[model samples]
Target: MKILLLLLTVSVVMAQAQAPHIDSSYSDGQIQAFLKDGFERNDRLLQAKAYYLLAAREQNGGINNEYTITYLQKSHELFAASRDAYHLHRAKLALALSYVDQKTFDQAFDLQREALTYFEQRNDLFMATHAAASLANTYKLMGNLPQERVYLERCETNNKLLKDNILSLAILNSKVVNFQRQRQYDQALSAAHQLLTIARASKKTNFEIAGLFFEGILHQFKGQYQTAIGKLFDCLSLISNPNLSPEAMQCYLHLSQCYEALHDYPHAYQYSQRYGQASHAILNNQRQTALQRQTLRFDAEGKRRQIANLEKEKREAEQTALWQRTITIGIGIAAFVLFCALFSVLYFHRQKTRSDQIIENQKEEIKQKEINELRQELTLQNVQAIVTGQETERERIAKDLHDSLGGMLSTVRLRFDALKTGQPTHAYEQALDMLDNTIREVRHIAHNLQPDALLQFGLTAAINDLVNRTHSPATPDINFQTYGQEFALTPTQSLTIFRIIQELLYNAIKHAKASEILVQLNWQTPSLMILVEDDGVGYDTTQIQTGMGTKNIQTRVAYLNAHLEVQSVPDEGTTVVVTVGV
Candidate 1:
């Protein structure tokens, strides 16, 4: 716990030292599309901005990986080439921050200083304040508190000129950490109070929670256990879902310590148990997420290889045809020129040319036929994959029932028989527990196969049921909205669409790590549009060809001749839109 608290303080300091940027209105895919258009139009400024947006998207994804640095570098070069000094310096500041994240302090320090000077000279306090904050963060990481404080002061001065509460909030957060690190509880407490006031005024729940937690820690350090407990409780209450929040865990941990310090063993034990449960839940979630990612990666690799093979074959065939046509055309032109002076030879050449044209038409038809056949083969394969996946799922459920439930029932029967012959106390209770677990497993399997609401009510009811079942404290909040009137569809069509939405929601919850999800359905005459959007960690669509869930969705979409579009930006989120003829 001592080590945990020490690490917590350092992490809090680092986290609060940097200013948080607003989420981008556009997704990564949308930006990439814009970038492609810009390149085609030879718009250097647009290209530079797009590159910078990509860099910011990468930063929002929580790391300074190679892609982030490369994008920023590209953006910087383009801005310089376009002679856009304002944006060029902005790019330099971003690059400096990226370097800081990479822990390349030397480069970060130099670039940050240069950008800060530029912004200050131009009287751009907004950018200048950010530049100062970043430099301070770098210094903080390098363990130079005095120098860190100096730049932090610089940030405060610029922020005063700008009068931005968001900027002030960031500065105070770092101040709390700095003061606490220096063992100055009074100053730290003051900063914490200021942070709490600004956060509450802005209605930023997360920052408010952070401020309360900081105050609790400061109070605890000053040996005011009762006061600390109150502050921690307030922090815990502000969290919408305690079980799903790391903040809740922090509060529980500190509350337990505060109680223990006061020799209140019962409350301490209670909070300690809650903390343990929260920690275990978090760990399980992390493990499950890691397993899902590994599975997706394996699936994506296989699909990519298959697609590559198909493309290679197509390219080879096209190349062969191109060479054959080129050679024939060259020979035909040469023969025509050589025979132009002789009447009889010219007449023979015209007849041969007519025959050659017929042969070319035949070859073109054959090529078209082959292309059609190839497309048909691809379609058949996708259908087969979907069917095979369904069969696999059925087999898995059958195995679960046969092995797990069957074994449990046999054990229960034996236990009952032994009980009749006189067994140990609580034998009946144990048998009941086993029976209860078996019942729950049976219901779970049945629900996966087909929901009762789907059969009894319809698509809307089933979807509502799904949202209710899938949304939990451990998962993101899912909001289902419908625009226009509901439309009728056959049972099979409804089930297909339901499955597609189900897979999308699963991806958002298990894979995307989304905080919130919105599933909207728009019903129109003879058509329906489905949109699923999530504020989660998005991916570069160009790099990822497909996944198992994506394949499933694609199969269904093809069946209905629907149009599907997916747009995503790293850290910004993902939006999936599907339009189908009802």
Candidate 2:
């Protein structure tokens, strides 16, 4: 179970570490706007950069993969057209990587080699080292271990000269992969160990996990089934989300194989089943990605056709205008004047019609805007009313339970104690104990109905109390921390925040099955940030977006006009960050 749990998170780490760094300072809309601005200003360089940025963004998100490649190609063209050699080579490198991802090794190899030569010629070791590493990876994928080794050697030399730990790690990873492919188990194992040491020293858990995985593979290839199982399980133990990790799938498959070799049918079957599920999930993801790329391709093609048609129409209109001018030049002055007068009348008539249409459209738009605003206001009011009513009812119930039922239970316990003291009977003592339990249960219910600490102490104290109440040996340990000076909040805001945190905690404990949870509050000058994180079996955010819990949280978030970001990967855990204007 521990092995499987660790395997689950491997994807999360690998997914983070594997992606190229992308600038997210500007949004997709902003980038597109910049692209438009560049076109309008006849700035090819700006347009090229925008296209590259868009491609990088798409690559990072794994969206529109085919369109991303197209964007990179266009960016490369624009850079070359603008005589930007450096950017052109950079774009070529991006394009090559994209081709590698798509398994088009021929194109990838050519482009990568070109970019590599450019960087090497300039003695740009930083870029050259990465280019060599990428080329090696491409060769590795193509089953050309000799070529891969050649590039790996180059990468090693460059890294040695530069003394870059990151570059060294990349080189080591490449060597491990190449050695494994070459069936040099001893060399591969050594490289894996070195990789693991460097990864651990650098605190790169993802690389460490990768090294462990490679070690297990090497051991398995050497026919050390038990040793391989141990190493594979070690790899799995480090991962958080096995279902999403290809490494996890490999781990499961190898574990199954190892168990089968050991004649452990039950364990083998269990791992085989896990491997099947992981494979199915991965296949589905691949299919979805392919479909998205295909859709983007279709959309791009359609837009291209539309642009072509529009340009054709513009050209035809220009030709007609030229013909009209040439005919008018040959016509008499009276005929030309009469034609101009007729054209002016028709144009004015069309202009008046367009103006009327525009006026009506504007009026309709204003009406719709007003309706939307009114609807939103009503929704807010309704939510506020419902919450206010629920709190009021909760308060009433808590008061009744505490002051009425609680008092009665306590009184009964006292009377039973007094009677027991007089009689000194076992029956009376048992009744007294029962009364004590009843009294405690009533108080517990009352406390839950409406926490007095929240009403008296503020958000910080209330959260602490919640953490204390939620924590137990059977539940995930809750860690509560606050930073910055505390700020005051209205009763509603305080309650809403508390409820949001409470729901998050419940989800983490009950659904996530986490071992640990962290709740943080940071009160800044204008905004308060609340973060709830858990190291639990996470869920697919896309799949769970419309869940009731999510909807409820979103509603509360809307009420506060707050920004909420939820990042989760299967088996890795979930992190929810909410930023609210104070």
Per-candidate Cα lDDT values, in order, are 0.78, 0.81
lDDT of 1: 0.78
* Count of backbone collisions within predicted model 1: 1
Question: Residue 561: error of model 2 in Å?
Answer: 97
| CA error at residue 507 for candidate 1, angstroms | 99
lDDT of 2: 0.81
Which predicted model would earn the best lDDT? 2
Per-residue lDDT of model 1, residues 1-582, tens digit only = 111111112122211112222223455446655566556556677777877877675565444467678878988999899999988888887898788778899988888888889988998777777777777788888888778789878877877777767667778888888888888899999999999999999987777988999999899999999999999999988989888688898889999999999999999999999999999888888788768666655654463355345446646766887899999999998898777756677788888999999999999999999999999888877775775577468657756765677667767766776666565658766866777777666755657566668768888789888899888799998999988888788776787788889899998999888889999988887899999999999999889778889988998888777899999999899999999897
Clashing pairs in model 2? 6-239, 7-236, 7-242, 8-240, 8-241, 8-242, 9-239, 9-240, 9-241, 240-571
Against the true structure, what is each candidate's TM-score? 0.46, 0.46
Among all windows of 10 consecutive residues in model 1, the one with the lowest summed lDDT is 1-10
